[model samples]
Target: MADVLGLYNYWVVIFLMMTGFYIVISRRNLIKKVIGLSIFQTSVFLLYITIGKVRGGTAPIVADGFEVYSNPLPSVLILTAIVVGVATASVALALVVRIREAYETIEEDEIFEQDR
Candidate 1:
């Protein structure tokens, strides 16, 4: 039962990642593309958190009477990645807003046309 639940969680993370990638690559709207990129980034965050989770491990912080501590490296890495992701998302969103204001439309093709 526990193994099945774990496998299911893994599958969900993979599905989210694939879907997010497909959206980012295939979508045409600028805002939609940013949304997709955010989703993809978040899916990666989820993956990191999932991997960091231990079946029966304790926190890495040294305290009183602690035996097994799960690895904290993954959590720390994910925290950094999440901050970077937010920065990227903010920049992308700002770019999309600028594109919309400049071209009067958020469609990728329209923006390209205005650029040319």
Candidate 2:
């Protein structure tokens, strides 16, 4: 039962990764693509968070007789990645907005046809 529960998070991570990838690839709208990108980023964040979890562990701060503590590195790295990911998503959405303004359509094929 413990092993099965532990594997649940892995399944979720895999599902999120695959769903994000599919959305990004199968969708044609710029806004939708951005949403998919965010999903992908969220999965990455979740992976880090899940990997950082430690059974019978406490916070990194000093405590009375608490010897087991989860590694803080993954969480720290995830925090940085989240910030960068937010920045990236903002930039991408901004670009999408600009494209919408210039082309009057958010669809990739529409933009291509308009360009031609």
Candidate 3:
């Protein structure tokens, strides 16, 4: 029970990942797919933060009394990833807007049918 509770973050990550994947695959609306992708991206971010956490760890800085310093690389990388993810999501939404404008619909199946 203790072990399972300790890994709760991982369980949440798995749940979010699956839910996002399902939404992306099962939904026919392009907006829904984009939202699903954002959820999936959020799960990845949570997973990384969970992995980087350390018990009784201090910030990665030179201190006189601190010994167990947590590594900052993961957090730094995640920050950069968040910026990139936002840009990517914005671009995806912009494309979706353009697609909607061109096709007069945002449904994936409808768009495909129109193309056909």
Candidate 4:
């Protein structure tokens, strides 16, 4: 029980990842697919944050008598990833809007059917 509690973050990450994957795989609506992609990205962000955390560690700032400092690299990388994800999501949604305009529906099957 103690170990399970200690690793709860990992469990949650796994659950979020699976849920997002399922949504993306099973849902045909363009907006729902975008939401799933966002959820998947969120799980990745949480995973990075969890990996960057150190027990009894201080921030990367140097101070007197601080021996353990968490690495700032992962956090920085995640920040960049977040920016890129937002940009990609916006573009994707824009495309979805165009798709809706062209096809009159956002469902994947409907879009393909209309394309035929």
Error of 3 at 91 (Å): 1.0
* Global Cα lDDT for candidate 3: 0.93
TM-score list, all predictions: 0.82, 0.90, 0.89, 0.88
Estimate, for each residue in 31-54, the C-alpha lDDT of model 3 and write its tens digit.
Answer: 999999999999998899888878
In the range 1-116, model 2's lDDT, one tens digit per residue, is: 99999899989998998899999999999999999989988998999888988989887777899999987989899989999999999999999989999999999999999999
Specify the poorest-scoring 10-residue window by lDDT in model 1: 48-57
In candidate 4 the C-alpha lDDT for residue 36 amounts to 96
**Candidate 4 Cα outliers beyond 4 Å, as residue runs:** 1-3
Name the lDDT of candidate 4: 0.94
Candidate 1 stretches greater than 4 Å from native: 1-6, 113-116
Clashes per candidate, residues 3 or more apart or on different chains: 0, 0, 0, 0
RMSD of each: 2.2, 1.5, 1.6, 1.7
Model 2 segments more than 4 A misplaced: 1-4
Predicted structure 3, TM vs. truth: 0.89
